[model samples]
Target chain A: MTKEHIVSAFDRDLEGIQATVMKMGGLVEEALRGAIKALETGDTELAQKVRKSDRSVDELDLKVKHDAARILALRSPTASDLRLVLSVIEISAHLERCGDYAKNIAKRSIVLAENAQIEGTVPALRRMATFVLSMLSDALDAYIRKDASLAEAVIERDLEADDMYNTLFRSLLTHMMEDPRSIAAGMHLHFIAKNIERVGDHATGIAEQTIYVVTGALPEDDRPKKDGTSITFKPSDE
Target chain B: MTKEHIVSAFDRDLEGIQATVMKMGGLVEEALRGAIKALETGDTELAQKVRKSDRSVDELDLKVKHDAARILALRSPTASDLRLVLSVIEISAHLERCGDYAKNIAKRSIVLAENAQIEGTVPALRRMATFVLSMLSDALDAYIRKDASLAEAVIERDLEADDMYNTLFRSLLTHMMEDPRSIAAGMHLHFIAKNIERVGDHATGIAEQTIYVVTGALPEDDRPKKDGTSITFKPSDE
Candidate 1:
């Protein structure tokens, strides 16, 4: 084969790997959204669907990781190519973790669906999930396009999600205090917030991976502070 | 250098890295135990000590990871040796995460010490922390000794810790429901149990790393259950 042909083949492999990782990311985001929606709507069927879908994410995780490793072993590429392969592998792990967090939320959703009505909890969680999903999607975009600025934007967006979680946590804590009957439900709500918070964390991990791929440096964790103030909702704002 | 000398030199480096990882593991276990003790006893001073000691764990993590990566890049070892180095890197990440969880517990203890009495919540949390500490230490031992069976045991022990978390969570939820004033304190206690539960997860991650090092095969999550009932805990005879 010509040298140009060989290089093109390697590029194609990298593109294929990136595509799979993005697909996996999409599946994880969907799972998280489904799980949170199930909790919000008390839809056990949706929760069950989220749980079953996790297996596909796991399978994709293994496939992408194996394929990346196989490419590395065969091509023995160095520098940028090596970084690209490594980033794909790491991002796959992060996506798999996101899937696990979604599964955990689904498990808690099933329990919450059984006892109490989830009236006030789902909105906060959905907002947090939306922020995390965008971060993950943008990070993947930055990675594919090699856009460092876009990766930095994802890092910056993570603070907003953290703030949302803090607000959600305090509000849920107050809700549980007001209604004894909703204590179990509130705890479940708290866990869902936590899962969403971790989803943001995993998104930040993806951003770090992207930064590493671009600059060969790890990104620092720069989560915002909550300062212990309770978030009170305004009815007009909702 | 002669072949014998070269082999012996590599062996010494491997042994040194293993010893350092074990020492770091012990320090992490101590930090976990001290943090939980501080929480249980409401000792801010002890909590401060645990927080201070975590710096050393972080330093050890950096050193071990660097050494392992250096060995991998410089020595270019194959097969089992390569797996050992990779496992050390992953295991160090898990250990560092465990230390972070310990630090989080210590930080919470300081806050809990200020306002609320956590006497009822601490014992169960301590039990779970102890279980995680043992699993972490045992997993390190299994790694150093190449005992797959022991690593498997550590994996099995994680379920017990998970059960402890669920029980503690339910009890704390009940406490918050019984008295609205206890909500903040209960939340702090809930976070403590969660930190220990996370420590157990890190221990399981370490066990999986150890297994990968020994056999180059990753273990399944293997959480036992039957007929929709999670077999994570048996009713405590206490």
Candidate 2:
């Protein structure tokens, strides 16, 4: 191959790898939405479908890794090119993790569906899932467009999800406190809530990668993570 | 600069990055042990210490990425050499995640100590924490030596930690059910337990990277993941 042909071929390889990552990202967003919808509606079959489809997500993860590795070795792209290759690898992994969290949510849906529905819990969780899915989709768009502001915007919204989780966790606690019957369902719902919270985290992670890729700098570390605060409480003397 | 000098410089760069990864791994192990000790003894001071030290972990993560990217750009390593660099990048990220989990466990310890301790729970968690730390240390050792069998051994031990988590979850549930008083503490302990469980997962992730680096193949997928199984229970009618 001529020198010109080789350069064009490298560009094509990078583009192809990125396109695969986008496809994987789209699938992951769908899985998150589908999982939450299934849980909200007690659609066990849709939950099962979400769980089963993760195989393709896993396969895409491997492909992204493999192709990125090949590009790194063969093309020896530098600067922004190198950053894009590395970001593709990192972003692909984050997308895969989102896929896993979605699968976790879907798996928990089966159990939640069988048990008594915890009041107000499903709707809160459904909202959190939708919010994070939007963040993820936006993060993917920011990555594709190399829009750092959009990526930072996604990061800024993470604390909102955390606040929602803390509220939901306490409400579930009060529900269980009022009625002993809700404990089993409460525990499952709590985990599902936690799973959705993690989906937000992974979305933020994708945005972080995007910021790093665009500016070649670390994302801001200003957000004070108020994570374990939700678990703190006044010791009720029984 | 001669090609030979450039090649030797790449070798030195790889060595430096690997050494940094080892340092990060050691710190992560210490953080895990310290976090668990803090929980075991209700030492809020030590918990704060573990959380404070994670900044260094994050810095090392960035440093590893920087050095690895430089090697990829400047040297263009081949075959096993490329795999080793990629593995170092992945393993460093896994170690950073392990550090994050340790920090999370420590953060939750403050709440657990302030509130009433669920009877017999801290000791169980301490044991699980110790078990996972040993696995992490062993996994790191295996990575340094490229010992596939030892790495696979670490992977095999993950289910042990999972079983421990399942048993502890049930016990915590039983405790909460028997007395409304234990609910707050039980919930905090449950999250701490889950964080420790995730530490095990990250350690296994490092081991999987070790296996990949040594064998140039995916780790065996024979072990069935029994996760999300702990949430399944027959709800007792109140």
Q: Largest DockQ belongs to which candidate?
A: 2
Off by over 4 Å in 1: A1-16, A68-77, A220-238, B1-20, B52-75, B224-238
Measured on C-alpha atoms, candidate 1 has an lDDT of 0.75
The lDDT leader among the candidates is: 2
Candidate 1 lDDT over A24-68, as tens digits, reads 988998998898888778787898899889889988987886676
Give, for candidate 2 chain B, the lowest lDDT window spanning 10 residues: B229-238
Candidate 2 per-residue C-alpha lDDT over B1-238 given as tens digits, one digit per residue, 9 for 90 to 100: 6555555677888889999999999899999899999888889899889989999998999999999988998888877888899999999989888888888888778777877788899999999998988999999999898898998899889999988888899898888888877777778788888888877888898898888887776665455454645344632210
Clashes of 2: 0
lDDT of 2 by residue, A104-214 (tens): 888888778888988788989988888888889899999989999999999999999988888888898898888877787788788888888878888888898889888
Rate residue B172 of model 2 by lDDT: 87
Global fold similarity of model 1 (TM-score): 0.86
- Tens-digit lDDT track of model 1 for B1-238: 6555556677888888888888888888888888888877778789888878877887887677557545654565666776676577668778877887887788777777766674467777777777878888888888888888999998888878877787787787778888887887777677777778887777788888878877777787455420111111223201
Clashing pairs in model 2, backbone N/Cα/C closer than 3 A:
none
